[model samples]
Target: MNLAMKISDHDVLLVIDVQNDFCTGGALAVPGGEKVVPAVNRIAQKFANVVLTQDWHPEDHVSFAPNHPGKQPFQTIELDYGIQVLWPTHCVKGTAGAEFHRDLDIARANLVVRKGFRRGIDSYSALFENDKRTPTGLLGYLRERELKTVFVTGLALDFCVRFSAEDARKAGFEVAVIEDACRGIDLGGTVAATHQSFRDLGISVVGLEAFL
Candidate 1:
């Protein structure tokens, strides 16, 4: 695990969904989510290009458990795209939960991509919505900016961070995940499964020291 990679201008640091809802004392908190803030802040300083992602869902978003009768949070239901995990009502637009974590330093970020805002669709990846067809415009933004590699970090490693890394690879960009700068929901062995997926996708899982 000798990651002696240099931080170049062609690389971008993608901080994904480090919002209040995913942190402590919010609607849908991931364990130790707030702990990522410091790690992300420190690593972000090494990158010249930074992009932040936010999960800004509508109140009646399809992924919410309350939107589906008799379904509970963490339950899975089939949608037009595929299986959708129901979440607690969280990160509603214009709400405090949708805002970035208070301790997350975003001053260096040049772009902020907001996803999951559509009432009928859910977006887990910064590059694409959950449907895998609907573009979030991030891929184009990166391409236009000539960013050849993407270093991802932030909340819920099993979901958003994992999906973002995969999509970034699928879109032909080199991708890596800063493991220590992320937290996970870890529903039913998802953390282990995500690691397997990352291996299969050729996504590097490095620690904060990779940048330090």
Candidate 2:
């Protein structure tokens, strides 16, 4: 809503899993997922610090539906942290689906943090794996850089983007989600729930105009 907000070096942009597997025609594609690329790329040019997180998983990663035998994608199962939705076999390490979207601008990124690589765990938050305490080292990197605020964007707003925003806020950084620069899978009103959760958590859900 703050159209005139000035972006500074302390305000870092976190691009969450804008990879081939989440884009248009991907194995786990979110509807309109590819639409966020241009806005994210455009916003990236304005940030002094840009960090990109990729959903890099191994072939037998625990989140995969194939590993669960009878389960299917989007089916909820209990994990140690809580219930986790089983996902399709995608973003396997060294696979084309694991790669960032072809049109995404990665040149401006200061750091590229790869997550969900460990075979036993699934990582939705860029800062922390699903275990919650296990860090991906992003917090330390941001702290070392003296960054204070995080502007988040990229694929599947209800999942990775939501988790990243919540974790960023919990890590003591002011957080904002660039709404227009994100798309959601939106299973069962998840997008609306995410918006309400963001409001409850005091995370700003702003339009692209907030930066432009």
Candidate 3:
């Protein structure tokens, strides 16, 4: 690992949804999600400013099947919140699946951002919830601490990490995504296309070791 790079205390290292919900044996497991743990841990050890995001949702969250009528998991539904993607019932508040992955070193974390608590909206991104409407106070927290550059890495690069990186860019922060420290759910070529989209948006997509 590259311990030679100059890192500031203000540079925030954001770990998004590194929970069991997107890990192996979870209801909403992202393919290859478990693989990022070690890389993420190495990054955590190298960064002093570490923030972890959690998907803390209620059982009847509108994004879940039990709340949406005639909608099943993986289905798309248009609601007042905008394009909502229904997901499996996972990450219920205080549930074991909502906890951070066992392979992750949670001890190194400094801040915790808990999102997706509202029943009416689904929050795939740690920065903004559905439709870019709900601010998860992540920007404010980062701004208060004078953190302008954010390196985000977590489960499902095609979704959560992608969306979060976009919002981070929109929020006027420099964003970098450690591609190796993330997994994607694309059985098709969408993951590759999404990577290009991120490139188009000027989001730095690099391997975890690139920071070293």
Ranking by lDDT: 1, 2, 3
Query: Candidate 1, after superposition: displacement of residue 210 in Å?
Result: 1.5
TM-scores of all models?
0.98, 0.97, 0.92
Error of 2 at 58 (Å): 0.4
lDDT of 2 by residue, 1-212 (tens): 37666998789999999999998888899898889999999999899899999998999999999999899898989988888889999999899999999999999998999999999889999999998989999999999989999999998899999999999998899999999999998999999999999999999988887777
lDDT by residue (1-212, candidate 1, tens digit) is 36776888999999999999898899999999999999999998889999999999888999999999999999999999999999999999999999998888989899999999999999999989988999999999999999998999998899999999999998899889999999999999999999999999899899887777
- lDDT (CA) per prediction: 0.93, 0.92, 0.84
lDDT of 3: 0.84
> Per-residue lDDT for 23 in model 1?
87
RMSD of each: 1.0, 1.0, 2.3
- Model 1 sits at a Cα RMSD from the real structure of 1.0
lDDT of 3 by residue, 1-212 (tens): 24244568877888989899899889899977888999999988878899999999988898897677777787878888677778889899999999999889989888898999998888888888876877999888888989878888897788888888889888888788888898898745758987887878788776755666
TM-score of 3: 0.92
